[model samples]
Target: MTDKAKQYLELFLVFFKLGAFTFGGGYAMIPLIRNEVVSKRNWVEDEEFMEMLALAQSAPGPISLNTALFIGNKRMGFKGGLVSGIALIIPSFVIILIIAMFLVKFKENAVVERVFKGIRPAVVALIAAPLYMLGKSANVNKKNIWIPIVVVALVAFLSVSPIYIIIGSIVLGLLHFLYIKKIHKR
Candidate 1:
């Protein structure tokens, strides 16, 4: 096979393995993705990976697929993005399809319900683990630490919609940008 073909296949296989083995969902897959893309393949530097992760989280859709698309595009352009996304989704699609086929029948089963209930807390922990890592990488120090804390409190306690938070963050970023530009002029 040609080098380009090999690269595509490698991308497919790596994401495929991640899709197949990972549990709990997109957030849970972050570390595994870091392991493969940052450590194993050396496709992106740690800083770049963190940036991609942030972008992926902010984008609309699954974080895992978004991360794959961003990294793939960065590495090999549009086709790479498409291939990585499809590969990452294929395994989950198949698994969900199979589950859907049986889920209706087993919906009322006590044992199945218990199994799902048990999985919920672990999924929460999986999601939290990535959040903690991302927060650290984001330089959430004493000066800016309260930003996330406030966001989390609003979402968790006050039941604020995340869309507002995203918009507020965007506005804050713009203000910061303008402030920096003004400083440079002065």
Candidate 2:
């Protein structure tokens, strides 16, 4: 096969494997994404991967799928994005389709219910692991650490909508940029 075709197939297979095996959800997939894209394939630098993770989280849709699209588009443009995204979702789609067909009948099974119960804490840890790594990469030092703490508090305790937090962060970043620009002009 041609080089381009090889690249597309690589993308598809990589994401297919991730989607097929990962248990929890999008957030839980972050570490696997980092392993594949940043370490294994060398598609993006560590900082770029972290930035993509942030963008994927802030934007609508699943983080895993968004990361796939962003990385694919960055590497090979629109076709790459489409292929990567479709491949990433295909396994999950198939699995869910099968599950949906039989889920109702198994919903009352004690073993199945217990399995889900055990998965919950594991999923939480999987999600939190990436958050900690991303936070450190984003420079969450003591000086600015309060920002994330406050946001988490708001969402967890106060039940604030994440939309407001995202918007507020954007506004804050823009204002900071302007402030620095004004200071430089003085």
Candidate 3:
């Protein structure tokens, strides 16, 4: 195979490993992805990784797939994107397929129900871990810290829809942007 082909294959294999091992979706996969791609392979720098992450979040499709595509493209161009995207998703596809088949056959079993019940709390904890990590990484300033506090308070006390929180964040972001622009113009 050509050098580019080999590179693409490597991308596929690396991402296949990441996808197979990571649980609890994209955010959970991030630190692992950073370790592998940035720390181990030296494929991208930390700042670049963060930028790709931001782009991945803003793009269409799953965050993992978007991340894989961006990194792969950076490494080996279009073919790398194809290989990495497929690799990132394939594990979940196969695993879910197998689980679906098994669930269809044995969902009513007491042992399976018990196992699922045990897994549920662990899954929630896994999801929360990434949120905690992101909060630390974001380094919220005094001005922005209240955004999360108000959102949490509203969600906890008032039971507001999450969409309101999202909209509020957007509004706050816009106001911050305008303020910064005004300050720069002065």
Q: Write the per-residue lDDT of candidate 1 for residues 1-186, one digit (tens) a residue.
A: 999999999988988998899987786799999999999989999998998788898888888889989978987899999999999889989989999999998979999899989999998887677876788878888999999999989999999999999899999989999999999999
Residue-by-residue lDDT tens digits, candidate 3, 5-62: 7887889899999999998687778999999999999999999899889989977578
Q: What is the lDDT for 29 in model 1?
A: 92
The true-structure Cα RMSD of candidate 3 reads 3.6
Q: What are the Cα lDDT values of the candidates? A: 0.90, 0.89, 0.87
State the displacement of the C-alpha of residue 87, model 1, in Å, after optimal TM-score superposition: 0.7
Q: How many pairs of residues collide in model 2?
A: 0
| Superposed Cα deviation of residue 69, candidate 3 (Å) | 1.3
Deviation in Å, model 2, residue 61 alpha carbon? 4.8
For candidate 3, which ten residues in a row score worst on lDDT?
A: 126-135
lDDT of 2 by residue, 1-186 (tens): 999999999988888888889877786789998999899989999998898888998788888889989988988899999988998899989988999999988978999999989998998887677877888877899899999989989999999999999889999999999999999999
**Considering only N, C-alpha and C atoms within 3 Å, which residue pairs clash in candidate 3?**
none
lDDT, residue 86, candidate 2: 91
TM-score for candidate 2 = 0.67
Overlapping backbone residue pairs in candidate 3 total 0
**Model 1 residue 154 lDDT score:** 95
Model 2: worst 10 consecutive residues (lDDT sum) = 126-135
